[model samples]
Target: MFAKSTNEKPESIKRVEKVTGRLVIFYEVDICNKSELHKIFKLHKIDCVIHLAAFKYVGESVKTPLAYYVNNISTSLVLLEVMQECRVKKLIFSSSSNVYGNPKFLPVTEDHCTGQNCTNPYGRSKYFVEEILKDVCTSDPDWRVILLRYFAPSGAHRSGLIGEDPLSEHLNLIPCIAQVAAGQRTKIKIFGQDYNTRDGTCIRDYTHVTDIADGHVKALKKISEDLFKGWTAYNLAAGKGYTVLEIIKIFEKVAKRNIKYELFDRRTVGRSWQDDDLKTVKTTKVVGKRYIVLHAGNKNGFIPGADLVFSSSTKNSDYHGEMNQAAKLQNVQTLLEAHFGKEWAQHDNLEWYKNILKGLKDSENENSQDQEYEEEECNSLEDEIAIHI
Candidate 1:
C-alpha cells in the first residue's frame, strides 16, 4: 500500500520486514496522487494491497473537515482506481470502530446501525469510505475486499522495538500513559470520569499492537484463499473494555509507583476513542496470544532514554546509591537529585524533617488531609541540603 508521508513509511517497512524473510520493498508515494500510485502498482507484483494510510486525528478532523474527507475518503477512491487499472482485484482496507459512533447498545454488534452516532469528521470519513468500498466491491464482482475494523492498539511488540511512533505530539492514550510513567509528563489527565460506565470513566478495549498486526496477516491469508471472496468486515478488539481509572491503576502498579491523575469535566476535546464489536475473532483467532495484562512491576512509564542515561550517570558517581534511591522515590526525587544532590536529603532538624514527612505520608494514606503538595517543595530541597550532606 502507498503511504502518504515519507517519515511514516519507515515504520511500515520495519513492521512488514519482521514477518517476511524475503526482501520487502516499501515506496513512499502519496495515495492521494493517482499517477504516482498507478506507476507504483505497475512496478510491484502486489497480489493484494492492505491500505492503511490515512489522516486519523479526530479533533483535527473536526477543525479541518475538508482535509479529513479528502485525505481519508478521496485517497481510498484513488487507491481503488489504481487497483482497478492494475487488475489487482483483492484489497484489505483498514477500517475503524468510530464508524459505529456512540454505541446504541453496549458491546456493539456489526449489525448495529452505523453513521448515526459518528460524532466527528474522522468518524464520518471512515463511515463514508466504508460505504465507498462497499459500492466499489458490489458494482464489480471481480473486486474482493476485506475491511478490518481495529480497536485501540497499544503495547509495543514483546521486544518493545517496533510500534506506533508518531513523530510529533502524541494523540493516543497508551503513549500518553507511557510518557507520564517515563516521567516526561508531570501528571496524567483523565478526560472524562462521568461517563455512564463502571468507575464513571470512559472504557476502551486496548489491543496489543502485535495482535492487531497479526490480524492484518490473517486478512491477507483469507485473501490468498479461493474461498475468501467478495467484501467482508470484522472487528478486531480484545473482546473487553477497560475504564480509564482501571488503566491508570494498572500503569501505576506496573511502574511500581503512584500515578497522579485528575478528572477533567470540561476538557472534552475528544470523547473516548474506544469501541467494542460483536463480530468476534471466531474465524481467525490470533494464535499464541489472546489477552493483554497491565502487569505489576513492569517498570514501564514515561521514562525516555535520556532520563535513563542521566540516572545511570548519577549511579556511576561515588554517591550513586543515594541518587538511585532518590530517583526512584518519584518525579520530584529525580529532579531534586539531578539538581541538588544529597544535601537536599539534609535538614536543620533531621528528626523533625523525618517526622514531618512521616506525618504527611500518614495523612495522605488516611485520606484525612486533602492538601496537594507543590512540586517546588521538593524541587530545590536537594540544593538547600547540599552543605549538610
Candidate 2:
C-alpha cells in the first residue's frame, strides 16, 4: 500500500475520489511484509488490488540482479501469500513486454514463449512472478489472477497534473519528449538508429498509462465472473508500433517545434543485440467481436451515434438544459459526422447521453462542493462515449 508523495497533485486524489464516490484513503506500508499487508487488507474491504509497483529499469536490473529479484519477485510472493491468507482472491498484476524477450513472430500472441531470452533480471523477475501466479491458480481454485503485460506508457492524466514522475533522474522517451516540449531539456536522444527497422531504429508499441489503469478496472469487472475466475492474462498494448524518429516527429508536430536528437552507439540489449538488426513485435489487438464491429465502424467513418450526440450536448448545452445561443447543434452534428463518420448514425445507444447527463447532474448537485470539483481535460475521455453511452 502506497500513499501520495509530494509529486502527486490534489487533482489526482480528486479524480480517484470522484470516480469511487467516496473519501479516498491513503495507506503507507511495505507490501513485502506479510503481517503488514494482511493487517491492511483485514482493515478494509479491498474488492480489487491493482499491483503497479515493481523495479522497471532494464539496464540497472542487469547490474543489480539480486536487488531486482528481491524487490520484484520476493515482494510479489509476499503479497500473494498475504492475499491468500486474507481470502482476497481478486488480483490484477502489472506485467511487462520485456517478459516476451526477443519475440519469435511479428505480432506476439499470449501463447508466445516468454522468459526465453530475457536479457535482464527485471524481465525474468516478472516472468517468475507470472509463473508463480500460474502455479497458485493451478493449486487453488478460488484465486483469480489477471496478468496484464504492458507496453511503453505515454502521456499524462490529461490534466497535466498527474504524470509519470519516476524517482530516477533518467527519463523515458515520452516523458523526455514532454520535458523537451516544456523547454526543460534542450534535445532528445535517439538511443540507437542503425538497427534494421523501416527507419533503422528500434520500434515499440506505446499505450497510454491511463488506458492501462482503465484496463485494470475492466479486468476487475470480469474477476467476479466464472470465465476469469482462474489465472488469465492479457496484453494491454496500443496495437501499433512507432519508431523513435516517428515519435519525435509526432512530438514536434504536437508541440509545433523541432526536436533535436543524435544517435548513440550503445549496445542494443532488449530486442536486438547489434546495431544492424532492429527487432520489433507488432502490437496485439483487442480480440473480441464487439471490438471487430467497432474497428469496422472506425474504418467506415462511423462512430457510435451517442458520441456525436454527447459531444454536441457538452458544447451546446449551458451546464443544464439551457442551450448556448452561439452553439449550433447542426455544426456539432457536422463535426461529429466528419470526425466519427457514419457509424455514429448507425449505432443506437443512449449510454453516452447518460454519462454526459451524469456528469452534468453531478456538476449541478447541491451537495457537490466547488473545491471538490477539479478541472480535468482528457482527450481519451472523448472516447468515453464509445461503448458506455
Candidate 3:
C-alpha cells in the first residue's frame, strides 16, 4: 500500500505497519509541492487516492485563515493536477459536516445546502474542494469521487496502537474531556450553557473513527464499481446529537473519574471579551459580589458566568450514547450495511470511549515507568539532602 506523510512520526508509521502487516510505502513529502508529489505518482502505480491532507482545526482556522486556505485549498489543487497528469481518476475525499454550518433542520442529509454560513475557514475549504471535485467530474466522465462528510470522529483503533494525537492544543470536546479526566488539564471550559437545546448546551453528532474508516473503505469500493460514476456525498455520523454535559457525564461514568469544568458565555471573535480579559475577571475580588458583562451581539448584555459556576457531578443517566434509529436511513450507513451487514455499521460509542480511556491510562503508566527509571539513574545532592531530611 502507498501512503504520504507530512506531520506523522516514524513511530506512528511503524505502529501502523505492525498492525496492518504490510509494508506501507510512505513518501515524506508535502502535498503542496507539485514536483515532489508528481515523483510519487511516477514511482508507484496508485490506482485510487484517499485525499485526507488538510488543516482541520476550526478555531485555529479562524485564527490563521491564510494558512488554512493556502494549505487546504492549494494542496487539493496540486494533488488533482498531478493525479490528472498521472491518469489516476478515483478519489475518496475526507470532508467535514461543518460544510453544512448551523443546520437548518435536524438529521442533516447529503442534500443539505453547503457553503452557506460556514463558521470557519476549515469548513469553507472543504466545501470549496467538494465543489472542485464536482466540476472535475462534470468535465471528465471517467473521474469518480466520493466525499465523506464526517461528524466528530472519536476513539482509537481497537488495538490502541494509533489514535488522535493533536500536535498542538486539544480543541475538540473529546480530547478536552480526556485531558481533564487524566488530570493533565485543570478543568474544561464550556463555551455557553444557554443554547436552545435539551440541556441548554449545543448538541453534536459524533461517530467512532473506526466506523468512519469503514465508511471510507465502503466509499472506495463503491467508487471502484464499473457502474458508479460522477461525484456523490455522504454523512458519516451517528445521526443523533449529544449535549456537551451528556458527554462529560458519560465519560465520568465510564472512566470512574471526576471531570471538572467551568462555563463561560459563548463568544467567538468580533465584539467579544478576549482570554486575557476573562482571566482578569476570574481573578478579581469584589467587596460584595462580582459582575462581568458579556456582549452577546445585542442591546442588553448578558452575565458572563452560568448559574452553576462549576460542576464535577458524577450523576448517571440512562443515556448510553446510542446511534439514532433514523441514522439507518442515511445513504452511507445504508450502503455500508447492505454490503457488509447490520453489525458492520453499528458501534457502541460508550464502549469506544472506554477503550480510549484505557489507552490513555496505559500511556500514563508507561510514562510513569520511564520517569522512575530516569530518577533511578540520577544521583544529586538535593536527592541525598531530601532523603536525610
The top-ranked prediction according to TM-score is: 3
189-244: candidate 3 lDDT, tens digit per residue: 88666555556555678799889989998998899889999998999998667878
Q: Please name the candidate that would achieve the greatest lDDT relative to the true structure.
A: 3
The weakest ten consecutive residues by lDDT in model 2 span 285-294
Tens digits of per-residue lDDT, candidate 2, 278-366, equal 35443322121221011212333344442322222243212323321223334444556666576444222333233333454445544
All candidates: TM-score: 0.66, 0.65, 0.68
Number of colliding residue pairs in model 1: 11
As a whole number from 0 to 100, the lDDT of residue 12 in candidate 1 is 61
Q: Which stretches of candidate 1 lie over 4 Å from their true place?
A: 6-22, 266-389
Model 2 stretches with alpha carbons more than 4 Å out: 1-15, 18-22, 266-268, 272-389
Candidate 3 vs. truth: CA RMSD? 25.8
Q: Write the per-residue lDDT of candidate 1 for residues 235-281, one digit (tens) a residue.
A: 88887898888888888888886778877752333345333433331
Better of 1 and 3 by TM-score: 3
For model 3, the run of ten residues with the poorest summed lDDT: 269-278
* Stretches > 4 Å off in candidate 3: 1-6, 267-389
Better of 1 and 2 by lDDT: 2
Q: Ten residues in a row with the worst lDDT in model 1?
A: 290-299
Return whichever of 1 and 3 wins on lDDT.
Answer: 3
